[model samples]
Target chain A: MKRYGEFNALNGASFQTGEDARVVALLGPSGGGKSTLLRVLGGLLVPEEGSVLVNGVALPKDPEGALEALRQNGFVFQGYNLFPHLTALQNVTLPLMVVHGQSEQAAQQRGQELLTRLGLFDHLHKRPAELSGGQQQRAAIARALAPKPRLLLLDEPTSALDPVMTGEVLDVIRELAQEGQQIVLATHEISFARQVADWVVFLANGTVQESSTSVKFFYDPMSSLAKEYLTALTKYR
Target chain B: MPNSLTRRLIWTFVLIAGASLLLYATFASVHYPWNWSNAWSYRFQFLWGWGTTLAISLGASIVSILVGFGLMVGRRSPTTPLRLFCHGTVELLRGSPLLVQLLLGYYILANRLNINDPILVGMILLGFFEGAYLAEIFRGAVESIGASQREAAKAVGFNKVQMYRHVIIPQAIRRALPGTTGQLVSLIKDSSLLSVIGIEELVQKVRIMNSSSYTALEGYLPLAAAYLIVTLPLSWYASRLERRFAFET
Candidate 1:
């Protein structure tokens, strides 16, 4: 994570957790460096001076570095950005062929299985435009979880959705939590975080403002920034 | 009704104009018409010449597409030097006139390098020229793809090449198609310029016929018709391809 410009997006951000960790939520104001931290972990961006460890080993960023980060983690975006050109099926299976070295048949089979699991079986042949917002979010989730990744990074998984669609997406997220995979989600969803987030990490101004069990963070957050944020947020609600 | 009436009027005017031109040719050629006995001799020559033009243009287009895509990829490379080199190659090709490139490629460089095959040189020359333009088209399409798609692909465990091959290129190529097809038509027309280098394309062959037979109308009329016949269907097909696809929007 070496950026040439002025801002340090992830200033002194640090965390450590178990291998099968589930739902550690990154709560933040916009441009608070939470997404940058995720990008560093995703190996899409390299930090100037930080070591990202997975099971106590340094994540590599060399030839197979991005692929290596890709291997361990699946990233979900707020926008549910599926490829408009490809059918839902092709979008899911593409990485299987390119990185996992799966045969086309295997990729297709796996893609079908994943889409089916996400309740997108009937929607598999249609392009993203044909899907509802929730369906597209599920498709994005299916694409992420297709390889049974060890860790998942979700950036504001429900930030852009309507209230009904947000609930729909949160239900899927909860279902994933029940399956026992590690997920670190960056979100603006307050009550949903209280319900499902195992731990809540309030990040603001490029540093960790507070990290607490979801109960304590919602009921009695320590940091002034977290307190102010939750106050401002709940005021709107 | 108005649109249909305008269309009918256009067709009527086109047919009348064509008939008048043909009648004028009949008189101009009456003094020395294309002798039916001699038609076969010249027709075969025209066929061979036109075939060369088509081959050159098509071959050039294919080469240009592959090369241009490679250049686009290189331009998008993370390493600065590689990106600079790709950018320089694009700028160099776009800046120079294709005619000058043709001369340099077919005569000067080919001779200097001891490359005797004019056909290969000609194809490379045309392909490289068209490729530079196609590179920009491809680059724009690639950039236009939502960063979200690339992120999604990467998030799904695709490396850079995988992201490009699986996600980016397919989407980019689709958007770039109609524009490239239009470019291909222009490339086909541009192939006639190769005749200046003694490649004996349709235009050059027509010139030979005009001089040899001393019947400008007899020679030029059919050649112009041939060029139209070859180009029109292609242009019309390109128009369909531009409009028919749903993914473009």
Candidate 2:
């Protein structure tokens, strides 16, 4: 469990992804430990208790092990924390050159290709603040994808965007999902999660309420908490 | 409508003219004898003193920045003893007056160590004095970076050194510029205090000139002008750097 001060952000939270699942979505209300769980899965945070096993290998608590796990995964934050001092192209290339030890020419080529694919070619030279919200988030995604991570962890990636910008970012993720990218997403967009996620893990009160296939969870939720949450979200739909 | 450049020039001219008028009036009211010839004879001495002051300021500025950066890193180190040592040093330097520190450093500390060079001791003391302030400025600048920035870097699999080198330092440098430049200006002015330790800098030369010429106004007015000449360009250059480093946000 992960405790922030006196509050337990994740207490006895456990679930396993399906064998054939390409995308796993964590669905819950605000402050229900979705973000904290995603962070733990990515090895960005170490829990005070419990073990995390990814791909049948237990995550070691040592710093070196955590670093190795992080290297294999890419995390996109809700706020799109792109380095403000760097342009979009530099933001993507800097990590590759500095952390991954790629040469300048190779890093630049990879950064340019990823950014162009994300529809950020025209804004590659612009800094984060100069770009629109959708553009900045796309740049952040391109930076995440530049390293060719085995698994991508995204925490509410479009929570800060307007409807149009939200649609733009979601479309990019959907395309990635369609390309058979392994992704674990925590989000509040019910419809978008329904469309993209192969498996669903519902969390509440820092505990896993239900873990099932997306078809089963959406059409016939077994847990009462999951039923209440789905009804509350679908009340107006 | 007036363009911005014309308006700025107009305001500059008015302010300068006003300041000149104020100085003239203040001097006229004194009704003192104006004998610049006696002080003018010491031009070479004054030039030498000014050059020395400039050299000391430049050396001290570089030394202080290096010390400050080291101290800031120490303060953030995981080792408790090093962090406390750095903290205590900053407090001691910032708590006491520079005059007292110089006297103690030269007369007591240097004597015990058997180092007789007054200029070197004085420069070191001045640099340490300013370094305490700069340490705090750097710490504040580094802390001002959001937690998300660090997390993002960590998510990209950056080690501590790589994170700081690739991500944190660039942003911190930009944030620290204004405060760092302000501290540097203060450093230049504070160099005059080193005259207490017989550095023979500008202020010390002015004292010698005044004692001989018995013309305080003539001797001291130029001393003030000499300091302004150095500090004004520094501040102007600082503003230019501020503009160049300014990101959109």
Candidate 3:
């Protein structure tokens, strides 16, 4: 949660998860602390009052541990921001060599295998500027997936893409969820949320207005804020 | 028409003066009492002088990048002492006159320390002198890469060292090239100053010949051509690199 100059972007907001929900979506309007909540989860923010419990440990007590948790978790941004100087292979292999303690040779080999599997083998040597929008996003997904994190955190994964490109990137995410990876995303792609998200959270003004199964959240939102937010978001072209 | 024609002529004059410089050694090679024995011998001297100048320039550039890279990394270190030390080094190098640093390094440091090798002294002084500017370019380039980039890498489980070695430093180096051309060209020109240090780099040998031959034209004209032969192609490649990184960015 963000402390934006005496205003609490997320004021004591709390959340819980089901036993085996694979894809959880934080669906919300702008300024609702969706990004701030992600920042908190990513250990980039510290609330003035209250704590975050992840994997049975309270946060901010140990900044180092919080950072480690954040590291073990993968974050995918909406912009598909890849390093322009680097090739797809180098981008994927970086974390493998950095975090996972793999040698350059091993990382290169695995990076090659991952990119080939992602259908980016041909683009392996091409810099980010040389790749198409969809290819870059797929390569970003490949980078996130390389370390094999337990929790995959995505920030509006498909917002920057056109409908066709969105479909292509979302398809990769869908395939990942099908393989039983726990996917947590802050997104505005309502269609993907409704279709693929097992659990959905509707946040407004820095608080979770509603949380329920995707079927229930869409078909019948309990809060007026959630309904209005969904209506406004859906009405947005 | 006359006024505009005068302005056009003046503009062309300025272009010639700026882009083309008269080489002192070129006239020295072929004119006056100290003229070379033949055109073939003059051409050979010219080629050798140009090659040596290129070597000096290239050598200075490589040293500048390596030393600058290390100083830049030190600037980013979290430890207070290391950071301050790097900061002080950059300030000392950039603040003091480069010529002074070169003279100081050559005379005070090298001479008293019994390091009689003038080539080694020239290399050290040139590297240290140019590294300050290079450090600034590198630091700015690395900083301009958005904080989001590093945060993303950190989240992906890469440690601080890995973040720099793999992702950040490479991008920073590539990004700094445009700003760095000034340093590169300056370094090349700066090599001429090394003649005073007794390094027989292009300009030094010409000075030796000039004093002995007593003919400015025969001793200095070819040396100037040699200098151009080294710098012109370098500036060309620097321009090409600027264009490439512009598109990449």
Which candidate number has the best lDDT? 2
Candidate 2 clashes between residue pairs 3 or more apart in a chain or in different chains: none
Q: On lDDT, who's better, 1 or 3?
A: 1
Give the number of the best model, judged by TM-score: 2
The clash count of every prediction, one per candidate, is: 5, 0, 16
- Local accuracy of candidate 1 as per-residue lDDT tens digits, B111-169: 99998887888888888888888998899989988877777776777767677877787
Ranking the candidates on DockQ from highest down gives 2, 1, 3
| Cα lDDT of model 3 by residue, B1-249, tens digit | 569979999998998776555533553566535555533334555566566667777777899998898898889889999999999999999998877887888889998999998777787789888998899889999898887788777777666777787668777766888778878888887887887776666666666556655545555666666666666777779888776655374
Better of 1 and 2 by lDDT: 2
Q: In candidate 1, what are the lDDT values of residues A119-231, reduced to their tens digit?
A: 88889998888898889888988888877787888888888889898888888888888878788888888887888788877788778777778888888888888888889
Please write out the lDDT profile of model 2 over residues B1-249, one tens digit for every residue.
999999999999999999999998998998878999999999999999999999999989988999899999999999999999999999999999999999999999998999999888888899999999999999999988889999999998889998899788888888999899999989988999998888999998999999998879798899989999998999889889888888965
| Segments of candidate 2 deviating more than 4 angstroms | B1-3
Kindly report, for each predicted structure in the order presented, the TM-score of its chain A compared with the true chain A: 0.92, 0.98, 0.92
Worst 10 residues of 3 chain B by lDDT: B37-46
Candidate 1 lDDT at A17 equals 47
| Order of candidate numbers by TM-score, starting with the best | 2, 1, 3
Q: Which parts of model 1 are misplaced by more than 4 Å?
A: A1-4, A17-21, A61-63, B1-41, B77-86, B236-245
Q: Which ten residues in a row have the lowest lDDT in candidate 1 chain B?
A: B32-41
